[model samples]
Target: MVFVQYTVLGIFFLMELCALAAFSYWGFHLNRGWFIKILLGIGAPLLVAIFWGTFIAPKASIPVSIPVRIILQLIIFALAIAALYFSSKSMLAVVFLVVVVVEMIIMYSMGW
Candidate 1:
């Protein structure tokens, strides 16, 4: 059970990494000018970091109830998956979504 907890935590970390990567990928591949690309490449992930720090991190500044937190997590992960799918990586998006669902189920069932 402890091992499962640690594994779920690791999954959370991986999910965060995937979100940042998806945001970066979307920003950098914008069909706009180089300046816009650079701005978005930095700005998008910065915005997500701010949001996560404020509302979703372990030490969130403004923490919500567990249900709300889980909902927020799902929304964020869904966006990341959508980003991947729209960026022409549908298979990867599906895989990421599957992994996220499994992690969420385990976390919830284990009361993490």
Candidate 2:
């Protein structure tokens, strides 16, 4: 089960990388703004964080400390909403929203 999970996640990450690469290429070709690129970079880790916390970590036997976890969750959520609230462009907000959604999805999935 662990091996299968790893394989699936590996593929998912690879897909994300490919999408990032394509975005980079498109950015270079079209000269999209810097914020857009940065937003894309942020999305990658956020996705992993969300996936692991939600889909993977809960199955582990040991209990994670709730207070610290809650703090971290709030931080991510704030970043997501903050990016939207502060900025005019869609890319930043969208990227952060993706992160926020991923985090929430995992938390919800694990019944946290």
Candidate 3:
């Protein structure tokens, strides 16, 4: 049981990393100048990292209730899925969404 819980947590961490990558991927694929691409590709994930560290991380600077935290997480995941979809990775987006939904269900059931 402990191992399963830890595994789920690890998967959640991977999902977070995937969200950042989705942002970067979307930014890079935009039909814009190289400079703009570079800025957004780097900046989007940087801003997200800052926000997550500040409010959503395990040791967040400004902690919120679990429900709020879950909502914030879902928003991020949704944005990531949208990013992938708009970037022409519809299959990947669907897969990510399914994984996120399943993981969220497990996480909630496990009280994590």
Q: Please name the candidate that would achieve the greatest lDDT relative to the true structure.
A: 3
Q: Residue 41 error for model 2, in Å?
A: 5.3
In model 2, which runs have C-alpha deviations exceeding 4 angstroms?
A: 1-63, 89-112
- Candidate 3 lDDT by residue in tens digits, 9-86: 999999999999999999999999999999999999999999899899999999988999999999999999999999
Q: Is candidate 1 or candidate 3 better by lDDT?
A: 3
TM-score of candidate 2 on Cα atoms, chains taken together: 0.34
> What's the TM-score of every candidate structure?
0.94, 0.34, 0.98
Candidate-wise lDDT, in order = 0.88, 0.50, 0.96
The top-ranked prediction according to TM-score is 3
Better of 2 and 3 by lDDT: 3
Which sections of candidate 1 miss by over 4 Å?
none
Pick out the ten consecutive residues of candidate 3 with the lowest summed lDDT: 103-112
Error of 2 at 99 (Å): 16
* Pairs of colliding residues, candidate 2: 54-106
